[model samples]
Target: MLFRHFYNRLPLQLLSIRKHFLTNKQNYTVIKNTQTYHNYNIIPDVFDEAPNEPLIIQFKNGIEVDYGNILQPKDVLEPPIIQWEHDAKKYYTLCMLDVDLPTRLEPILRSFQLWFVGNILGQNYMETGETYANYIGIGPPKNTGYHRYVIFVCEQKNKIDYSPLIKGDLMLPRYRNHFNYKEFSKQYNLGIPIAGNFFLAQYDETVPKVYKKLNNLSLFVTPLK
Candidate 1:
């Protein structure tokens, strides 16, 4: 029973490496924010270029996020306060994309929409904007390497048309993958992300509860591979 409990807590990478020594402090490490976005390929993967500035993200627990830092899924279960500077006259949109859904190296499910808010003005005016997709916190499966939760704050020239853009009920996981950086930019000319930042997360003991609470729906469109 104890072993099974411990197994659930161990991330996929640790288990794959055969690190059974839970007592060894050396096995635990933190990804420092000092690392550049290139280290994680955020430049080409999520954005054409580096972010104009770092995004200010904090959870209900008072832990603030910095670029490339690692966090636990349970710690960020709620929609975080996303802050950025922009001209009040211009509308903006914020998107959180989980590039590594099922795995880090080969994301068969390339991008999973974590959150999306459109038509926001300066000062994090989310209420005025459309809540395209209500936030769903990170819940990477128990055996995927660390997943990157990338936030891209794009400058919107105008309000988005919901018609052809949004499909099925976004509240459901299947439809939430409705938007992506490439599509939005091509269609609306939203322009490159003005500001962005991301933090990494991995499967943890809290993930099981998250799945149950959310109807056990994952990035899988249906019973996929």
Candidate 2:
């Protein structure tokens, strides 16, 4: 019982140990919330794994989302400031999409790209990446219910060459609708996202107008049977 005796002799260390255990427990709770993403079929329906780490996202309107927290459409109208742990020397692809674009259950327009930035130096997307598509926030049509907005950070192999996809001095796919990230990633050799985060937003007064800000196409659909 030497260890017991040592622990009894150091109340402060025991307290520290207890505190550390609770901190880890809280972190685990946060990580476990990814189960909701899986439960919604967002896991296999899109990628294979639940994200391994946290990706922090905060909006200009003071909304911070990490674990699919439900946020007001008005608050996230603009692009969020995203940050995640990364290798400063490596490149990354930043992307955000609406997994439940038309409706939560039947999103025919699922994974409509809201933003895309290629070859960002680490997490510095603002200054380093070629912005193929500028940011557009949630615009889930009225009564379509809450939509999951997933932002993923894909670590890339090297500086991405845009010439292959560029046309008319700009990136192709002028409209953000109907994107296929898996194919795009394979084409560019971007491995699955190492880290990610998400938020939930429902249709609001701001949503009807949000579509007007995007590249070209927009949706206003009736739910399917």
TM-score of each: 0.76, 0.79
- Residue 105 displacement (Å), model 1: 1.9
The TM-score of predicted model 2 comes to 0.79
Per-residue CA lDDT of candidate 1, range 19-135, in tens?
555554322311222146778877566666566566788898787787878999989988888787788888888888888766777676667787777888675655687777777
lDDT tens per residue, model 2, 1-225: 999897778879778988898879847854685686687666866676666677788898667986768898899877888888899999988888888768877767766777878889977899988897777667777777788888889888888785564344222224555677677778888757777888888877786566566432343454333
lDDT computed for candidate 1: 0.72
> Local distance difference test, per candidate?
0.72, 0.74
Candidate 2: stretches off by over 4 Å: 1-8, 11-34, 163-174, 215-225
Clashes of each: 0, 0
